[model samples]
Each structure stands twice: as structure tokens, then as C-alpha cells.
Target: MVLYLQYNRGMTPTEAGQIMMLQAVMMTICAPIAGRLSDLWGSRVLATVGCLIIATGLGILVQVNDRMPLVVIAGSMMAIGLGHGLFSTPNNSTAIGTVAAAKLGIATATLNLARQCGQLLGTAVLSLLIAIFFDGRSITPQGYKDFQSVAVWALSISLAFSLMAAWFSSRKG
Candidate 1:
């Protein structure tokens, strides 16, 4: 996103980050609601729905281009953020809840570890995708179209992962 904003849209980092803030704002607002709902309906359904929403967002990103407006990008970013907000608590609670009481600490630690690892992996994947379409330093003006392709491919990969997560989330514990 920062890359696209900078290279493709000619946005400053501050501007790009401000645009990204829409996502965080949506996530912050929705998380508690998702938590409350998860408590009622249980993690499986909410988690599944959350992941599906994320996939939907990424599906939109999979078609993004230079001509696309920030509003659309911001909307999809909110979908991604909202999906994660809905996903995290329920997923964590269920993962931790399934553990024996005596092992709760270990379960929490394990869950956190997995989350960190996933974040690292996700970043690495995105970085690699960017690297594929960009030179080591930066994208040239001519490379905006290449970067667009990169974004599409990267988002498609993420969309696939979200779908898989939804599938897994739908399963019995």
C-alpha cells in the first residue's frame, strides 16, 4: 500500500499513512462488537465470517490499478481491517479456550508466537512480491504498471490464504 501510494499514485508517506488510517479506525471500532458477538455465537462462525470478509477485501484488491481511486482502496482496506478485527479475538479465545486450564499460559504464549510468526511471514511474502516487480532501490515511472501487476498478484495470493483460513475456521475444533 505504501509502495503503491508512493510509486504509483505519487503520494507522500504521510498522505499514504493517513489513507491507511481509515482501516485502523474501522478495525478499532468493530473489534469490540465482534468480541461481543463471538461470545454469543462462538468463534467458529464469527471467525469464518471474518476471514471471508477479508477474502472479499483482497478480492477487490486483486483487481486494483493506477486509475483506481483512493476511496475504493480505502474501502477495501477497511474490509481487510474489519475482517481482522472480527477474526482476532474469537480466534484467539477459541485457540486458548480449547487448552487445559493448567496449560493456559502455554496456550496463550503459543498463540502469540504463531501470530507473530504469521505477521513476519506475511511481511516477507509482500516484500518478496514487491521485490519481484521493483528494482532494489525504487520503482521507476515506467514501472507503475509492473507494480500494479505485482499488487494484483500479491493480493490474489493473500485472497487465497484468506479463503483457506475461512475454510479452516469453518471446521470443528
Candidate 2:
């Protein structure tokens, strides 16, 4: 969110709005298909593939600067969105399956807490980096390039983590 604002600083609000809208469309279109594929093929393959694709997408996204190229941005967004689609259901299923029905509430709470903590940590770290590097500038072509690069780095790390998770999930009975 902060990256989006900083990187696109020079753009009109309408342009920024359009980019966000495009992101929404891309996610909506790809998510369900990815989820369904995961259901059919198994999470191990889907999650691993999804993580790799998403990392590639983030790589592409980081390279885009100046005008928000719809093609590249949309493509990257779709890739990550599809990955989330693939990972979410199966990952949740595995976690849920690990607990008894009686303890499901506690399991879900723990999962939710972990997710929230991750989100908070990511947001804080990224926002701080963007502020320090960009000097609190609004989204400009150069700013976007810089922010996107960092975002890509973050995504790559996430993909590695996802791969590890998939590996562990596969080992379960």
C-alpha cells in the first residue's frame, strides 16, 4: 500500500485508482482457478509452483518504472494473486486438519494471530524502508522503481518460506 503510493507519486489519483482497479480484476479472475487447480493436483505442487511464479512476477514488477505498464503490473499482480489462491485453501486445510474438532477454535485463533503478526511486521518493515530510502517522497517513477525492487526482494523471501511450508505439509500423513 505505501509502496504503491510512493512509487506512483507523480500520477494523478485517477491513474493510481486505475492501477488498483486492475489489480482487483486480475486477482478476481485468477484466484478461483488457482484454488481449484490446487484442490485437484494437491497443495505441494500448486504451492511450490505458485511461489515460484509469484517470485518471478515480483521480479518483473520491480523492473517497471515511470508509467505503470498495465501489462507488467497486471501480470505480476495476477501471479501473486493466483499464488495466494493456490496456497490459502490447502494451507488452511492442513492447519485445520491438525487439530481436533474440539480444539479447532484455538487452532484458528493461533493461525489468525500468526497471520496478523506477519502482516504487521511486513507493513512496518516495508514502510520504514520506503521512508528511509525515498525520503518520504510520493510515488514517482524513480520512487516506484526503488520500492518495487524492495517489494520483489520481500516476495522472493516469502516464496522461499512458502516452499519450506509446502515441504513440511507434504510430510504429514
Please name the candidate that would achieve the greatest TM-score relative to the true structure: 1
lDDT of 1 by residue, 12-94 (tens): 99999988887788889888998899899999988999999999988987888877888999999999889989998899888
* TM-score against truth, every candidate: 0.92, 0.70
Q: Give residue 151's lDDT in candidate 2 (0 to 100).
A: 66
- Separately for all candidates shown, the number of backbone clashes (residues 3 or more apart, or on different chains) is 0, 5
**What's the TM for model 2?**
0.70
Q: Count steric clashes of candidate 1.
A: 0
List pairs with backbone clashes in candidate 1. Answer: none
For candidate 2, give the lDDT.
0.64
Candidate 2's residue-wise lDDT over 17-76, tens digit each? 665565466556766776677567766666556555555666666555556566667667
User: Which ranges of candidate 2 are over 4 A from the true structure?
Assistant: 1-9, 21-40, 134-173
Candidate 2, after superposition: displacement of residue 95 in Å?
A: 1.0
Question: Against the unseen true structure, what C-alpha lDDT does each candidate score?
Answer: 0.87, 0.64
